[model samples]
Target: MGSLEEDELVRMVRDFIESESPSPTNSSSSNCLALSHRTQYLILQDVLTGETSSEAKVLKHVLKHMKGRRDTKRSTSLRNWLVKNLKIDGLRASLCQTSWSTSLGCPAGEYEFIEVINEGENGRTERLIVDIDFRSQFELARPTQYYREMIDSVPVIFVGNEDRLCKIISLLCTAAKQSLKQKGLHVPPWRTTSYMQSKWLSGSRKELENPRNDYTGSAEIGNWVPPMVKPRKMDLPSASSALSCQFSNMSLNCCNV
Candidate 1:
């Protein structure tokens, strides 16, 4: 993301964080939380906009294949296809299944997403989380207009490092709590920040190995037809530009939930 676009998103999230709460007695606590959130948001922006990051390259290919696939297919099937195709393209990608036991009032659950491992400079390794349905993970049953717009601005396909994903989960979970409180509804345990963090952070990750001859009988293998006639490299900018436009006009609007 560009600096201008990043700043705009940060500002919008800040406004929501600093907005008045239903309980004025917790104003001090809310201020502290807002400060922490702002710090994490800035760190996340830095991680996302790193010029030397290999995530962009992997993400570009992911988006290309995703755009070329049938939308009716389930995410699991899409993820499997992506893992196979990415490996064929010489990228180390795999299906990551994360399962965690219930803790601190959060229920036990398992989540599956794609992950790409890249060997960075200086023998460093980077893990990128590629979530196809990222935005829906933060969705609420009923939300204020501002909250709805904020969540809607999140990219449908999220490609970021673990740190970036953690910060995003934290920020969104906090916002979810605020939105539910504003609606005079109870914040479910599943919506807690800890639960959200466990989904991607604190879990046993089992990477599914790519099978040999997996693509032999698949009709979708090695024959992706893009929806439009465009250069593979050029697709990234178009996708980012569309999301940037959405973030540009994002603003906090008061509404009864």
Candidate 2:
């Protein structure tokens, strides 16, 4: 990779259009530019010692020229122009992973497999499923004391007592329920109550599977919305024993503004 003057680069692009050096295959010239050619050209910039302030400024100016054309749909493609060139050859990274023949006991894309070569297995992989979500709920101290009474007082850090746990369960459930509504999906009527909240305390003196103290009361902004959109949860083979979410079961197995 070496630096060519900005004007030289422009001239090269024009020459590409004239000669059509990389013959467009099934894709249109616009498609090639947006998706592939653009990426290819950006890689070309690396050859230059863009480290200099003057170089950066010039580069910025050239890029600005493209921005002006962006409003034109033809100008606003995915790859910068260089990327389009990359796709013309055998340079494109496969869009997704390949090489695993999933087992009959599994479904496609359902199980995640990671490559591991150990214990005499050359390309062995382990099936893994990870489910996690922003959690807000914990016990409050003083079972006999109502939260309103203790509201003005310093909040007990952790240890949600039965009553506090009840509230947390209620609020989290409500929050989840409300959030599901916002996602344009419906939580099933039968499972709605369970998803809303559950109280599973073993006995007194023990601890609840208490969540952390960070209660956003809102969804962690960009975090995935809970996947409560099960078209049918009970019809599956494991329905009788299933009591958890398919998406964050931590069996496994958020919010507002």
For residues 23-113, write the lDDT of model 2, one tens digit per residue. 1111123322322223223322321122333223323433433343333332112222312222332232111122222232222221111
Q: Count the backbone clashes (under 3 Å) in each candidate.
A: 0, 32
- In model 1, pairs of residues that clash are none
Compared with the true structure, the alpha-carbon lDDT of candidate 1 equals: 0.68
Off by over 4 Å in 1: 1-32, 35-52, 68-70, 209-257
C-alpha RMSD by candidate, in order: 24.4, 32.1
- Alpha carbon deviation, residue 150, candidate 1 (Å): 1.2
**Local accuracy of candidate 1 as per-residue lDDT tens digits, 1-257:** 79997787677555544442422122222332554434444533543454245878888887777774434444566678778778888998889888888766889998888888899888988888888888889899998775676676677788877655655665567767878998999999888766776666654879876444433335556675568766666445678788877676563222322
